[model samples]
Target chain A: MLGTWSDGPTKSAIVDFVGRVTTEGPNYVVPEERVAVFDNDGTLWCEKPIYIQLDFIVRRLAEKAAADGSLADQQPYKAAVAGDLQWFGGAITKHYQGNDTDLKVLAGGIMSLHASMTVDDHAALVGKFYAEANHPTLGRPYLNCTYTPMVELLRYLETNGFTCYIVSGGGRDFMRPVTSQIYGIPPERVVGTAQNLKFEGADGHGELLIQPALDVFDDGPEKPVRIWSRIGRRPILSAGNSNGDDEMLHYSGKPGAAAMRLVVLHDDGEREFDYTAGAERILDHADQFGWTVVSMKNDWTTVFGD
Target chain B: MLGTWSDGPTKSAIVDFVGRVTTEGPNYVVPEERVAVFDNDGTLWCEKPIYIQLDFIVRRLAEKAAADGSLADQQPYKAAVAGDLQWFGGAITKHYQGNDTDLKVLAGGIMSLHASMTVDDHAALVGKFYAEANHPTLGRPYLNCTYTPMVELLRYLETNGFTCYIVSGGGRDFMRPVTSQIYGIPPERVVGTAQNLKFEGADGHGELLIQPALDVFDDGPEKPVRIWSRIGRRPILSAGNSNGDDEMLHYSGKPGAAAMRLVVLHDDGEREFDYTAGAERILDHADQFGWTVVSMKNDWTTVFGD
Candidate 1:
C-alpha cells in the first residue's frame, strides 16, 4: 500500500510493525481492540488555506446574503457577498463568539438553504465548488490536493483489521453527505464538529426537520478526547497533518500494547501545495516528539485520487 | 437463545426465524442489506415508570434541589427527594423535557469531574450510583433490570457475522461510558441520542475536556434516521420495545432483503413491568407485517444479569 515507502524508511517501519503484531511473529497477537483514527481535512484530503467545509459554508453564506438582501450588510457575511476573502476571515471568529442574535438563527439559515436538496444535490454542489474553486495557493480543485501517501496508509490500516475512523473539526452533517463516496469510509463512521438540530413534527403526523444551533468544535486536542468519548476505544494507529491532529497522534503514541503515530509534513510544492511557511508550530512539535514526520515531496509518487 | 420457547406460539416463531437465518436449509440465507437494530430501554432493560438515565438525572436533580432549598415546596423535586414512587409517573414526561436545562446546568458546573478522577474513581462512581439508586418500580439496581433473552439474541447475531449495533434514544455519551462493561459492546458499536458537547482545552495543556450543551432529542423515527446517517451500514436483524424503535424495525423489513424485525412485549408484571397500562404505544404492525413478537413472560428463564 505504501508505494513510495516500498523500499524506503516509511514503508519498512510500518511493515516491520505489522509483522510483529500478527500471529506469525514472536509477540504474535491480534488484540480485540484494534482501532485506528485519521484527521480528515489536511491529512486525508486537501485542507490548506481553508478547510473544504469552511469553503462550502462561506459560499452558502454569500449566496444567502445575495438573495435575501436583508443580511446584505451583516459584517463578514456582507464581505462574503462582496467576494472579499480578507473581511470573511476577520468575521468568522466574531461570529463564533455568540455575536449573532441567536446562533441557531444563523445556522438555521444555512440548514434551510441547503437541507431541501438530496445528498446527490449536495454532492453536485460540492463537486462543482471543488472543480471551479481554486485553493488560493495550490490553484487546483480542492479534491486534487489530497495526500497520496496518507490515502495508501488508510488502506494499509484497513487491511490489518483496524477500524479506521475520521475525527475532524469539520461539520459532521456536511461530511456525512459526501465522505463515503470520497473516502470509501461510510457516513456513519465520520465523526466531526456538529451543530445541534431539532426535530419538529408537522400537524402531529411525526415529520422530521433539521434545526441548527451552534454546538461544538471538534478540533486541536479535542480530537483525541472526543475520539475516546465517542468511540470508547483508543486508536492503536493515528495520522494527522496539523496542530489539530497533534493530540490524536499523542493519544495514539501513549504507552500501550501496540501503538503508532505518523505526522504528515507538507514539504512538497511541485506535486502538492506545501505549507512550510505558516504551519511552523505543527512542524516543530513533530520534530520534538520523536514521531515520524512524513515529507510529502520524498514520500509519494502521486497526490489525490487518480 | 429462545430457551423457554418450548411450545408457545411466540417462542416457536422466534426459533423458526433464527433457524432460517443461521442454518444451511432452504430458508437459511439472508440478503446482506437486511439489517436489524435493537433499542435498549424497556426493550432490553427495565425502563418502566422511569428510564435508567432519568433515574440518575432525577436523583441528581433532587439532590441539587435539596441542596439549593428548591425542593422544599416543589412538587416533582420534593416528591423525587422523598423517594415517592407513585408520584414519579405523573412527572415522567415533564421531567424528561425540563430535565435537559438542569442537566445542561449541572454538566456545565462539573469543571473537571472526570479529569481529576482516575479510571478506578470513575468506576467507583458508577458502582456507587448503581448501589444507591433503586428503580422506581422494580426495587432493584437498574442494571439488574436488563432482559436476559435479548442478550442471547445479540450474541447469536454476532456469531452469524451479522454486525450488531445498539441503536437507542438515550444519550450516546452516557450510554458509552458503561455499555462495554454491561453489554460487551464497545462504545463505537453503540449509537444513541445525545446532548451537544463542546470540547475545551484541559488543564491549560494539550489535553481536552468534553462539556455538554442543550440540544435535540433522538427518539422515535429519528433513531433510525440517525443510524442510517451515522453508521451507513444497515443491520439485517432488528429489535425494539416502544414506538421509538418503529422506524428501525421498518428499515429492517424493507423489500431489499429477507429480514426479520422482532418486538419484545413486556407482558409479565410479576417478572417484569407490563405494558398493558399503555406506557408505550405497541403498534399492530408487528403482527400484520409478520414480525416475531416475543412475550417477555414466556420467553426467558431470567430477566436481568445473572
Candidate 2:
C-alpha cells in the first residue's frame, strides 16, 4: 500500500511493525488498540519556507489590512506583511521574558479575524484559500505538497484496521477543511489547537460561533495532553519530524508497550526543502529512543504527488 | 438491529434517519459527515440512584477514609459519607453564589482519588470497580445496567457507516475502561471530562499521571465547545437526557443540516428508577425544538441487559 516508499530499512521496519501488530504475531495489538497518530506539518506534509497555517494567517492578515487600512498599523500584522524577522524575534524574546501580552494580542488578532462566523463558513473560506494557495518554494498548490509516501502509509494503516489521527500543531479548523479531502482522515480524528466557541441565536436556530482568543494551544507537551484528553487512548504508533512533536513521539514510544515511532528527516533538498530548523533536537532523541529515522532522500521513491 | 426497542415512533424515526443518511435518499449524508454522538449517563446507561461515577467516587472516598481517619474528618467527605443532601445543596447554592471554593475542594478530592496513578493502573482500577459494583437498586452489575436498546442503536449506526462517539460528562479515563467492553466503542472515540496529566519518570520510561484538578469540564455549553474543539465537526445525530446536553443537541440540530436529536426520558419506574431531576428542562426543550423524546416505559421493551 505504501508504494511511494522505497525498498529500504524504513519501509521494512514499518511493514514489520504493522505485521507484528495486525497479524497473529507476538506483538499483535488488538484492532481496538490500533491507533496511529501523525504530526501534520513536516511529517505528513511540507513545512518548509514557513508552516502552511502561518502562511494562511499572514495571507488573512494581509487581506484584512487591505480591507481595513487601520490593521496595517498593528505591530505584528505590519511586521508579518513586511516579513520582518526582527519583530518576530522580539516577540519570541518577550514571550521568553514572561511578557506574552503581545503574543496573545497577535494570536487573538489572528484568531478573531474569522470570529462570529459559523464553522461551516470559516471552513468554506479556508477551503477557498487552499484552492488558490501555493507553496512558496515548491510553486505547487499547498495541498499538493503533502508527502506521497506518508499519505500511502496512512492508507496502509487504515487498511489494516488502524484508526489514523492527525495530531497537528496547526489550527484545528484550518486543518479540518482539507484533511479529509487530502488524507482520508475525518475532521473529528484531526486534533489541533483551537479557539473558544460560542452557541449563538435563539433556541431552535443557533449557530456555533468560533471565538477569537486561544483556547487550547496544542503544541509541544499539549499535543500529548490533547491527545490524551480528546482521544482518551495512547497511540500505538506515532510519526513526527520537529521538536514540537518530540514529546508526543516520546509518549508514544514509552517503555513496556510494543509501539513504533518514526521521525521523518527532510534530507532530499532536490524533491523538498531540506532545512532541519526546529527539528534538530528530534534527530538526537530518535537515536536515543530507538525511533526509526526515515531519510526522505533514500526512503521515499516519490516526495509529493506533484 | 435495535431489538430491545419497541415498534414506536422513536425507533422508527431512528431507523428512518439512518436510512436517509446511508442510502441514496433525499437527505443522504456523505459517509464522512456521518458523526453520531451519545451522552453516556442516562442516555446510554443507567444514571439512576446517582451517577455511576459519583457512586465510584463515594466508594473510593470511603476506602480512603478506612485507610486514613483524617479524611473522614474532612467536611465534604464527612458530609458525603452521611449522604447529607443539605451539605450538597448548600455547596451548590454557594457555587451559584460565586464562591466555588467548596465545590472545587470537593471536585479536587474526587479527582485526586486516583491521582499519580498511571493510565493503565487507573483503568484497571476502574475496570475492577465495574466488575464488582452493582446497581444500587437493580442488583445487576453496572456494566449490565446499560440500555439494551441504546447498545443496539450504537451497533446499528456503526453498521451503517456512522462513526459513533460518546460525549459523556463522566471522567474520560473512567469511561474508557468500560465503554469498549460495554458499548463496543473504543477508548479513543470516548470524549469526557479530564484532569491535567504529567509525564513522570525519566525520558523513555515515564508514565502520564492524571492530575487532581479540572482541565476540560465537558458539560453544558462546554459540550459543544469540546465537540467543536476536539471533534472539529458538528455531529449529525446527538443523544442525551439532561439539560447539560441542550446546547450540544442544539448544535447538532442546526438549521441547514439533516440532523436528529433524541432525548431519553426515564419514566419506567418498574424496570428502572423514574425521575427527571436534572432533565426537566430538556423535556420542555424537546417539545419546543422538535427533538425526539424516547419514553422509557413505551419505547423500550427491555431497560437493561439484566
Candidate 3:
C-alpha cells in the first residue's frame, strides 16, 4: 500500500489505474507489458532552489577555479558561481533552446571536467558528492530529499509487476549511483542524457574511458524519442512535474493505449517549495490532456523521508 | 538440468560459474548484481550466410529498386544486392571499422529505408520480415534457428534471479521483436546499435519517427562503452562468439570482480557452421584471458530447437 499517500482523489486514481492494469480481464496487461517510467529531478525529489545536478556542476566548477584560478575568469564559470540568473539562464538555456554552438561549448566544458577519469573513477567522485552535498534550503543530504510518496509509489508499482524506470533530464551516470538505493530501480533502468565513452587498451585488456563529448541530450521531445529507442516499449504509466516532462507524459498517454499519466504539482510551501516554475504550461494543459495532477499539499501525507 | 548441453569442460565451467555466483559463499553475488550479457547473432542464433539484419536491408533495397530503377545503379546498392564481397565488405565494414563518412552514408541508406515510419510501424515491418524471411542454408525461419542450449542457459539464469541481456551488434529495433519470445529476454534488456529518432506531431500528441542518422554503433570496443552508459553495471557473466565481443568480454572480466566470460565457437559443421570467421583472435586468446570457449560440436548436445 502507498502509506505516504493521503486519502484523496489523486491516490484513488493511482490505485484504480494499477488495479485495472493488473487484474485478470480484457483490460489486464500482462506482466511483461507493465512498464512504468518516472522523471527524476522534481518528479522523484526536490529540484526547487536549483536542480541538484546543476548544484553538483557548480561545485565542480568552483573546485576547478580553486585549483587553476584562470577558470574563475571564464564567462559562464564566473556567472554560474556568482549565481547570476541572467547570464546563467542565457548560457544554459541556449543549449536547451536548440543553439548548436552553445550546446557544444557547454558540453565540452562539462565533459572536459571529468573526461580524463575512467567511468569507475567518475562514479566514485559522484558518490563522494552525494555523500557531502546538502539541499540549500532543506539543510539535509540531497539523497534524503526524495519524495516519500513517490518512493512508495515506485515500490507499489514494482510489486504489481511493473518495471519502473527513471527517465530523467539529469546525466545518466549521475543518477545511477543513488537511484538503486533510493528508488529500488537498477542502473540499467535509469535513462538520461549521456556522454560518449571510449574503449581503450589491447585485446582482452581494455577499459571504457568517458570521453569529452555529448551523446544524447534526453530532454523535451527527446524524452519520448529516448524512451522509444532505449526502452523499446511504450510505458503504460509515466510521472513527471515539469515542462521537460510534458512530451514524455503525452507520449505515454498516446491514443489506443490504456495509459495513465500523473503530474506532481509543487504547491505545498509549508512542507516544500511552492512555485510553478517551468511547469506552468504542463499544469494548465493537465485537464485538457486528461492527466491526473497530484498536488503535494493535498495528495501526500509526507514530503521527504526522515 | 541442462538437457541440451553435452558432457564437456565448457558445460562444467558454465555450471560451476553459475553455482559460485548464485549460492551463498565468498564469491556469491547479490541477486540485484546478477547481470548476464550475450551476443545475439552467432551466439544465440545463426549468422553464417550473413547477418539477418543485412538480409532485411538487402531485401528492402531490392523493393526500392523495383519501384524506382535508379537504385540498381548505385554503388553500395548494386554491390550489396549482387553479394559483391569487395564493395559490400568495404562499405558495410566501414561502419564497424570506424570510417565516419562511410558509416554516415551506410547509416543514411539504412535509416532512409524506415525513416518515415513510426517506432511502432517500423517494429511491425520488422515482424513481417521475420515471418517471411528464411535462413539461406538451414531452410527454416531465422527465429527458429536460435541455439537450444543458449536458450536453455538464458532461462536457467533467469530462474536463478540473473537478469539476461542481448548485447548484440545488430540494430536494436531489429532484435527486439523476437528476443522476448525466442530467448525470453525483454526489449529493455536488448542493447544494440541505434539511430536518432524524432518526436513528431502537436503538443500532447506525437509519435517517435526513426530518423536517418547514426546514434551508437554497438560493435568492437563500442560494446563496453554502451554497456557502461546504458546498463550502468558491470556484468558478472558475458557470452559472445566474435571479435566484436572482445572488448565486452574484457570489460566483464575486469579486475577484482568474480566474472565469467564464454565464447561460442561455431565449429560444429554438421549442426551449424565450421569456420571461426571474425572470432579467430578471440578463440586464440581465450586461454590467456581465462575465458571459456564453448564448442558447438563438443559442448552442445543439440544446436537448434525443434
lDDT of 2 by residue, A1-306 (tens): 888889978999999989888878678888867888999988998877667877787777777878888878886679767876455545534653557877776786787788888888989999999999998778799989899999999999988999999998878889998898899988878998887888764675567787877778877778877777767778899999987778888788446768998999988889897767667777888888788999999999889895
Local lDDT at B38 for model 3: 96
lDDT of 3 by residue, A1-306 (tens): 899899988899999989998998767888888989999988999886777887787778767767877878885567556765455445555554555565455556688788767888888999999999999889789999999999999989999999999999889999998888988888888999988788786656667787788877888888998888668888899999988888888788447657898999999999999987678768877878778999999999899997
Query: Could you tell which candidate, 1 or 3, scores higher by TM-score?
Result: 3
Error (Å) of candidate 1 at residue A24 is 11
Candidate 3, CAPRI quality class derived from DockQ: medium
Query: Which is superior by DockQ, 2 or 3?
Result: 3
Top candidate by lDDT: 3
In candidate 3, which residue ranges exceed 4 Å CA deviation?
A: A79-108, B79-108
Best DockQ among the predictions, by candidate number = 3
Model 3 — interface RMS deviation? 1.7
RMSD of each: 6.3, 2.8, 2.6
Answer with 1 or 2, whichever has the higher DockQ. Answer: 2
Q: Which ten residues in a row have the lowest lDDT in candidate 2 chain A?
A: A88-97
What does DockQ come to for candidate 1?
0.24
Residue by residue across B171-283, what tens digits does model 3's lDDT show? Answer: 99999988888888889889999888888756567788878877778888888888887788888899999888888888885577588899998889988899775777678
